[model samples]
Target: MLELLIIACLQDQCREFSKLYDPAEVSLLTCMMSGQSEVARWQAAYPEWQVDRWSCGERSTRAARL
Candidate 1:
């Protein structure tokens, strides 16, 4: 999955994004870097998450949900 994600990032943006994982939440930055369909890729990555949903580009709120 990391290799696939790196491929997507390298192909799409020529930039790098870091990865961090938690038992509770996922990162949108990680999702965008993966270059798969935004919604589908994210859900697939963390099928067991029980928290609320979220997205990137939010400000002043730490941007995490649930």
Candidate 2:
């Protein structure tokens, strides 16, 4: 599934966060189109924070070793 990545900050305190779109979009075009609303929702929740940048991509998974 794809995820929407967001980098936002309150003044100088920066943080990175992401969420997977419900049901998931198949292509980057779809992701980009839908990402705006997702961003808006995030902004509304944290009005004080400013969004530095955002994008959509496949979710990253950490490898496990024995």
Candidate 3:
């Protein structure tokens, strides 16, 4: 499986949001290719926070979620 990880910050506070995409359906290349648009959509919905960084990785690579 693949995971789309996004890190956003408001002032000095930060939060992470993650969603899983099955490898059977979405490959790593596809995840890498489309991650920016996903992050943009998330940022648009929550304009108060600025996205710090994002990446595609294997599931369970990170622990915190919101």
- RMSD list, candidates in order: 13.3, 4.1, 2.1
State each model's CA lDDT, in order: 0.37, 0.81, 0.88
Ranking by lDDT: 3, 2, 1
Q: Would you give me the overall lDDT of model 3?
A: 0.88
lDDT of 2 by residue, 1-66 (tens): 677889999889988878866444367678889889989999999899999999998765672212
Q: Which regions in candidate 3 have their CA more than 4 angstroms from the true location?
A: 61-66
Better of 2 and 3 by TM-score: 3
In candidate 3, what are the lDDT values of residues 1-66, reduced to their tens digit? 689988889999988888689999999999999999988998899999999999998887465454
lDDT of 3 at 3: 91
Q: What TM-score does structure 2 among the candidates reach?
A: 0.76
lDDT of 1: 0.37
With a 3 Å backbone cut-off (N, CA, C), the pairs that clash in candidate 2 are none
Tens-digit lDDT track for model 1 on 1-66? 121122123233433222334413545466455434654555467554322333333233344422
Deviation in Å, model 3, residue 5 alpha carbon: 0.3
